[model samples]
Target chain A: MSDKRNSETLPLAWIMPGALLLLWQASSSLGWLSANILPAPLSVLASAWTLTLDGTLPHNLGVSAARAVAGLLIGGGIGFGLGLLTGLSRISERLLDPTLQMVRNVPHLALIPMVIIWFGIEEEARLFLVALGVFFPIYLNTLHGIRNVDPQLIEMGRVYGMSPRRLFRRVILPGALPSILVGLRYALGIMWLTLIVAETIAAKSGIGHMAMNAREFMRTDIVVLSILIYALLGKLADSATKALERRFLRWNPAYRR
Target chain B: MSKNNGAALTLSQVTKRFGDTPVLHGIDLSIAPGSFVAIIGKSGCGKSTLLRVILGLEPASGGSVASDSDAAHARLIFQEPRLLPWASVAANVAVGLGERGDGPDGAAAARQALADVGLTGKADDWPSTLSGGQRQRVALARALVSNPTLLALDEPLGALDALTRIEMQSLLENVWQAQGFTALLVTHDVGEAVALADRVLLIDAGRVTLDQPIYLPRPRRRGDPAFAALEGAILERLLDASVSAGSR
Candidate 1:
């Protein structure tokens, strides 16, 4: 009975999108909507196909993905390291936390103009923007995760005479890992968002660049295709992170399913 | 270097203070090696604090607590299981090994410890999957895995159901006998103190008010007249101490 239900409803989530696409096709066929304003889904698909055949879509998609990953690694690594440092040491917290808190308040997007002035419209500016956008969530969550680990477990570690390093590895790190993964998931969301905006503003290549370039040509179909590509990529990145979380946090009862 | 049978722990005028509040007031006691001793007291009566001081989780403000062996060769089982939730049951138990090499050798020892605690097939299971009683058993495995010379339990079985608590008491005593570690259990349960300990220490207001020995043999029965007598005696001692403190 459960198997039958699973088969019946598992793809139920696709029904709405399918219905919307069908509605879009009917409206376009009946000439009820202007194609220039909002391209039909079929036209968008056709544009995607042509772009793929010409190697334009795949190349730009690759570039965007690479930039997103690079920014994530750079920002995520620094955030995680600093979080551990500040969380572990009172001296570090006192020294660096105030500066970080102040900086965290100013919107990261507002720095795009300054970033352009500093790094110009180069790839570095895009990377920096995405990195800055990704950093705070990872840093804040990592700090919270470490600081909130059960003190009882810490005492248990001490009772067993674990060295400081071992205590961090066996007790503190594993205890804080679920929260860190949560931060990573949030960071991934910000990574794509920042990259799209930065790329749209100034970029030689990438899906965001393609969308902006298509806007000038009034190629609404191509622009729609780029948006779809961004949506797919974001979903893909989210699913991958969720899979990683499942693997790492399987021992957590809350994450059992 | 000798594994002498008596007084593995010696406390000399040990005093612990939390800022202005003195929690342990010039307390002195001795605990024998290879024996089970229980410390019983009312809540906030410094029983747990005394265990912490003995375990060196906190330093005493005055005097000394010396273990006969290396301080590193000691372990504590807390009131809660306190298992590392992210680790497998075996890995959590293996944590008892403490900085020891952790590959196959540690795993084998962990498995053996689990078997000793009657959790032979649960080494790979996560702590979250275990029932409360099972989790505490895993904790016991962790405590015993290191082969520590001194094992301190701070109301370790307090959270367990009565039946599970009784089962754990037998398991604890059997393991203590087999391992021959000097065991110190701090608990509020007078019956528990009488059932398990070779000697029971009653504390009130940071002082050891009564130090009594239980001559009851192994596999002690709660229904036994002598067992009931001992529990009654310890209860009276605690009550008398509180009454005197109230009067003073």
Candidate 2:
């Protein structure tokens, strides 16, 4: 059924996006919208080319990518660890879950002003913002995954005289992996968005900084180019994570395709 | 061999109650070593509960149940395969050995067990890819790998289609003959009970209402008079219980 649907819809996926791009170009050429505020696709391409040749595009991209990756690693690690603890140990859940829930309810983005004030608009502030954004989704999903594992499987393990550590390692961890992977993917996307926002507000150089600087000079072409780069980066990160997920969860039914 | 002294299992005055209702009321039974015993009854007759008690999965409400064998004396094969979705076929089978790092010989033992179930080639395959019959075979292999002294099957073939059910029945008998482990099977299928068991124990409302020996020979034909007679007797007992319940 999925095969038939994929084959039937394959052409439309390409054609729809192509048609949208053509319509945007036509509108801009016909002056339906001002090119100053919304640059033509060609103008954006030209600005992107110029920026690439000058090495500024690559430099800013590297800065943004590094910050996002760093934040994801730290935040995802901490979240996964804590999530496992809360999911497996009732004591840990009772001790930490209420406080975490209260803190999670407060939007991490709302702490931007305080974070900047505390960390002084440096790399620390930007990274911390990205980490904070990535943390909650991963943590919550991990906890959910661990909690939802089949009780039957756990009983089977116990009947086999499996040690507590072995039961957790062999059954609980693998059972929770799919959910944990979902959390990781969600956290990575949020990490990128948060980094962009943070860099736009305070960074000296990064894709977000480039977009902000272009806005200041009314270089709408550069702004559009930077936004395109952001979109592409987000797609690339998502695809990479999906590839890793496939490798790890090859036995999963969802990953069969 | 002094076979008379080898008591396989004994459940003495096993009384189980749930809340205010009694399930197994002072039930007592003794199984000899290397015997195939079938417990047949209608649903909610507490046959499955008896198997669970024997497996140590559930505690008895009253009286004591004991196995002459060691702690790893018996293993259960549930109606569903219940294979771990994430583990490979070999890993699932090896899980029977618990968490004792069985060194390098573990893989070989797992493979041998799978071979016993005619699934040697599919060792690395995941449970998701397996058919219903294949999954049940893996479950059987998992139970067998432990070399259990007593095998408790809780309607293990109940979920299979007719053709698959017959095939699994034959495979189970073959495995049982080869291993020679004492088995207590709880099944709703009367023909299955007569085919596999040397003795049939019929339970109703958690008590053993009937204990009859099956004198049918090995390689018993389903169409034979003796097989049909046993099947009819068990069916009549079950229907009688249902009718009694209805009349009440």
DockQ of each: 0.84, 0.63
TM-score against native, each model: 0.95, 0.89
Taken in order, the candidates have interface RMSDs of 1.1, 1.2
Per-prediction TM-score, chain B alone = 0.95, 0.95
lDDT of each: 0.89, 0.87
- In candidate 1, what are the lDDT values of residues B133-154, reduced to their tens digit? 9999999989888788888999
Off by over 4 Å in 2: A1-35, A40-55, B1-7, B18-21, B99-104, B245-248
- Candidate 1 chain B weakest ten by summed lDDT: B1-10
Model 2 Cα lDDT, one tens digit per residue, A38-111? 99898899888899999999999999999998888888888988999999999999999999999998888889
User: Model 2 chain B — which ten-residue stretch has the worst lDDT?
Assistant: B1-10
Residue pairs whose backbone atoms clash in candidate 2:
none
